[model samples]
Target: MKYLADVTTIEYNADKCTGCGRCIEVCPHGVFDMNGKKAFITDKDLCMECGACANNCEFEAISVDYGVGCAAAVINSMISGGEPACGCSGDDGGSSSGACC
Candidate 1:
């Protein structure tokens, strides 16, 4: 399912990307694709803001505004004026309790 359609906070800098495909390899949501020798964000809306692509990018080409993926968290973040932190534990976007959902 679409996690946050039209609202992904992930940013990709092609100039910084080494085209090593690490982000593509690490992203669990298929949010990126190859664009010649660099990486392209093919589906930004599908992103869960989990930070997996950002953490895995050695060149620091990827950056994500991490968030706890829910409507309450979004409202809370707005009220608190703080960035949301997706509580994903790893590249697989699993919860801390080891659940995918």
Candidate 2:
């Protein structure tokens, strides 16, 4: 689920984290981890550009611009100047409407 580093906009401020585990709980990709009582990014590459963690963080520890899932195939493809091949066209990653894929 990794995208170009420049295109993904995940910004995490550990100093602002409260270790409430909200990010860890809401992230579809296990992007956050617990270290003592603070939350930290486990792998920035695993992020799908979904804004769940940012939207859920009450402490303002996380912030991100959204995109890069099956949902962004069309947009990302255009940016890369290629045919839509995000591996999302034919399959729904999981939603009944084929939205996840």
Candidate 3:
């Protein structure tokens, strides 16, 4: 899914990471790879903006503004005048649509 604004530029706060592999395990796009002990954004552009890494991270080390890079959500927000409600609005929902189902 091509996004208007690539949301793959992930922000990692090393201080917050606990070296947990949950993010790595859950990410469908394989955005993260373990570096020593902590997780790192190995492939930023390849990231689907899926927040699986962020959601699964207990330490809150990973964060991104958009999730899943869904054009539907952006279009919905543009037409509705508010943030889209496709579940992955920001930092509070699953990265996949499967969560909605």
Candidate 4:
């Protein structure tokens, strides 16, 4: 499937990573692999575009643009005439008002 560019891709900063393995633990897609002590993006294409790795990273080493990758979610939101929470709006879904639709 061709994913939209709105989905956040994972970017790794080698200098900031501390080999903590937290990102690996939280990722559902096995997008990362441990190289010695630090993490590397071994399978970027297999990524589900989830932000779990970025969220769990304490050192800010990993960055991703996360949002709902589900077509059903987008279609449903549109049908209902409401904005979706797909994270593609450049919002992290961390707001109290939940305005990231």
Which residue pairs show collisions in model 4? Answer: 8-65, 67-86, 68-86
lDDT of 4 by residue, 2-32 (tens): 3444344778898999999998898876778
Q: What C-alpha lDDT values do all the predictions have?
A: 0.74, 0.75, 0.68, 0.71
Who wins the TM-score comparison?
Answer: 1
Candidate closer to the true structure by TM-score (higher is better), 1 or 4: 1
Where does candidate 3 clash, by residue pair? 49-68
Question: Which ranges in model 1 have alpha carbons more than 4 Å from their true place?
Answer: 71-101
Give the TM-score (vs. native) of candidate 1: 0.68
- Candidate 3 residue-wise lDDT, 12-67, digit = tens: 88888888788888987777788998778766777665667777778889887654
Sorted by TM-score (best first), the order is 1, 3, 4, 2
- The TM-scores, one per candidate, come to 0.68, 0.64, 0.67, 0.66
TM-score, candidate 2, is 0.64
Report the Cα lDDT for candidate 3.
0.68
Which of candidates 1 and 3 reaches a greater TM-score? 1
